[model samples]
Target: MSMPICIIVSPVQESADEAIEGRLHLVDSHDPQVPVTDLGVTRGDGIFEVIGVVHGRPLALDAHLRRLANSAAMLDLPALELEAIRAAVLKTIDLDEHREELSVKIVVTRGVEGTGVPICWVLSFQTDDHRAERAEGIKVVLLSRGYPHDIAARAPWLLTGAKTLSYAINKAALREAARRGADDVIFTSTDGYVLEGPSASLIMKFGQRIWTPSTAQGILRGTTQGAAFEVFGRLGFATAEVLVGVDQLAAADAMWLASSTRLLAPVRLLDEHDVPVDHDLTDTVNAALLDTAR
Candidate 1:
């Protein structure tokens, strides 16, 4: 394992013409940095994006940055200098020696209480090995998200679409899955709509058609899912995003949890029921995803 590298970005929001390089400063990831009073620490008032680095390049970077901006806007934080953040991400990646497989995390906090400024940093670290999960797939249990499919429209304040730092619920769901003797969880809406995995986007395939849950259902838009769709499209598979029902899982020819770092892990078993796992197709999709550029 390699030590994580961090780069602090001062004045997260800067002019387009400003030199972003000078604003980025490399620091020890293990040392204290953020103030104890920061709202991200005190209230989890922040947003974050994780970008996977393959070989020496970052994958789906532009999409991840766009999502980060969306999250910040949803949180009512200051308009971020995306170019500056991009520079900091690249700098952090360059500073880290783990180039084979790494995950870059971009975090923007609401800053300390009483201070309106935002705190931002980019951290790059080696990713976990997901060979086993990707090859043999994972077992998952279906859990209720405790909200309806229309939650985003019903309560925008819930920040459903935003990838905020508050993830206690997601963690708890995974713990529940563990209690149920499952590897992961696929959260369903109270009204029986299939949502997504605790930390992944759910992808289901029915013959030639591939589908993922609609993002309007209060789920974060998935960057890796979009990339996977591209791969599926190239392979002559029609792709679409629609509202999926919990009962639809049993009818699917195959399903997988798509995420950064892990890439794609087929769901071999759902709620203890065996799910069809197309190892060959899974390998193809993952290979294309790993080969993705930018």
Candidate 2:
């Protein structure tokens, strides 16, 4: 494994004219940086974004930054200096020696208790090879997300749409999927509506239409899924974001989990039921996604 590159961004929010380069400082990834009293560590009060890099290019950067900002607003954290964050991300990517494929993570946390300031950092590391999952596909099991489809609207404080550090439940869901002999999980709302995977977005094809569960249901708006939608639209597939019932998974021609690092992995089996794997189409979509990075 390679040593990760880390860049600390002091005073996360700043004016454009402010010297951003002065604010970004390289740090040792192996050493402890975050304080124990930080809200992000104690209460999981923070927002984050991951950007995939291919051939030295960051994928869907603008979309990722936008989502980061949205998450900040949802958490009521201080406004982020997006331009500065972008510079830091690019700098970290440039500093990283491994250039084949990389995952860049941007994290902003409500600072240590009693401090109104926020803490931020940009880290870059090599990504795992996901060719097998993309080629052979993955087995998935459906699990209840323990909320209704309208929970985001009913309980705004739940922070459904934000990409925060509170991923214990998501990790537990994956473990549960493993116990059930599956590679991943698709969360369903209490009302029987399909949600998303633990760390990926669910994209299903029914006939010529490609649909992803609406983000309105409190799922994080998938940046990679948005890029995949563009590719599907160009290929003449009718694309949409709408409410989908859990029962509808059985009727799909094909399905896939879309994420930043893995790119796209077809779901071959849903709840032990064989789901179609469109290898050629999957390759075509993956090619486009990789090409965008180039």
Candidate 3:
């Protein structure tokens, strides 16, 4: 008897460019040949990064790659074939030149249970909801992460700052948020410090200044947030990394969830509290993000 193969094809965007569609690259993009013994599948022991593609060009590509490398290092994985991964990313984008907005995920699995080899692959697909969320904004609810702000520093084995595949809790948090009538979730530390969103970073505004939770507070360093901050600085906005609390969020001028795919999405409501949504600021931030991303 043969093992059943699962060939999953990524969905391309309808608004993508007309040139590249209805095509798949077997070796590069889609294949159902993962070894069942791979630790990534068995134990969720791996690292990954997702980059946003705009006009066939990946936004903040280098930054995302750097973060991927960092995650690999944190996991003590074998040396990454950076050049090969870069080539694969470019090839994936080339295969879908029509993708107006795409999300390319890079995954590096700690090979078959015992093998020293690592399985690295890139998967590209068109994103559907980022545009809508960015345009209309989103509602979020704060949930306790059940840990103190300094836990990451004390428990390095927890992999709190790494983008590992063990994201069951994060997904569960989002589902819980949806059940409560919110689109996303913001995790807070037990000590009452705001950490980050399940799949994005948190950014709050105070007048013309922007603030994000410090990485030292146990949040993943955000690539898109860093890029957006650079653009914000150019636009005459000050940026800082500090410990933010729910009370501070309530008093802020506006708040947003920033990520590689969504770029910058204004938070219109937080845990039923109406957050101040500055339309003009959102537009300006969005434009700057696009320009800087390109």
Candidate 4:
């Protein structure tokens, strides 16, 4: 049997003609041309966004731009000209020869010379995945509390809220799950408060209401999480940025990990506990979100 197909587009380019007001005049916005010997390659000096675009439109793009700028601030990179970046993205998608439904990753590396001094590149990749599974739900393994580096305090430095390229820990969490036979991992605080998945936000059910980890929980505010909560209001499901424990998760009628690509995956399994799926609630929420996404 063939393994599932995962799309990969490399060296995505940005427009050089776009004006940053100050960055450049009539610049071609070339891909990062720094030598393979650049210092950032060894020292990770960039920010990025894994955007999901459908029907040639980006989802929550403005929100993503806000987070991107925040991430750049956390890393002390140059101030990101949001409008310019947005235009570049729109232009890039228009240039994308492959038009199938795709998820695009928008990336911006700190300019090679100084902070916002010399941009490495603003790259975006358009991918095609036929086997993208909107999982029935997910099997989330609860991992240790708060980040190993006292993320609670140093999060501003680490940009917990910003979706940056420094995802070594995130990758390791996913690998640890794969090795142990699970789909994804959920980081939990010692008190059992849920944080988030390696790459997605944690959404759980509490009775007829919805709950997610608050900023105090040090979870990155997810775009999908934001969108879903909007639906929660319309659907009359009480939603809050509250902290939840595994026991609460086990007690809820449903659970899910929401993201752009995953959309809202019903989490049927969490660690050793097997959750009884509520297809009705899942279906309702999915339809509502899909409608809103459009």
Query: Model 2 RMSD to the real structure?
Result: 1.1
For residues 39-147, write the lDDT of model 3, one tens digit per residue.
9999999988888888767888888878888888889997665655666677777666445667788878888887777776677776656777887889999999999
Clashes of each: 0, 0, 1, 9
Over 64-178, each residue of candidate 1 has an lDDT whose tens digit, in order, gives: 9999999999999988988889988888878788866788999999999988999999998778899999999999999999999999999999999899999999999999999
Compared with the true structure, what per-residue lDDT tens digits does model 4 show for residues 69-143? Answer: 777777776566677667656655555554235566666665444433534343335443412334356677888
Q: What is the C-alpha lDDT of each candidate?
A: 0.91, 0.93, 0.79, 0.66
Candidate 1 — number of clashing residue pairs?
0
Give residue 207's lDDT in candidate 3 (0 to 100).
86
Compose the digit string of candidate 2's lDDT tens values, residues 197-229: 989999999999999999999998999999999
TM-score of each: 0.97, 0.98, 0.89, 0.81
- Model 4 C-alpha RMSD to native: 5.5
The reply for model 3, stretches above 4 Å from the true place, is: 1-30
As for TM-score, the candidate ahead, 1 or 4, is 1
Where in model 2 is the C-alpha error above 4 Å?
14-17
Superposed Cα deviation of residue 53, candidate 3 (Å): 0.4
State the lDDT at 13 in candidate 2. Answer: 45
List the pairs of residues colliding in candidate 1: none
Better of 2 and 3 by TM-score: 2
Candidate 2, residue 88: CA error in Å? 0.6
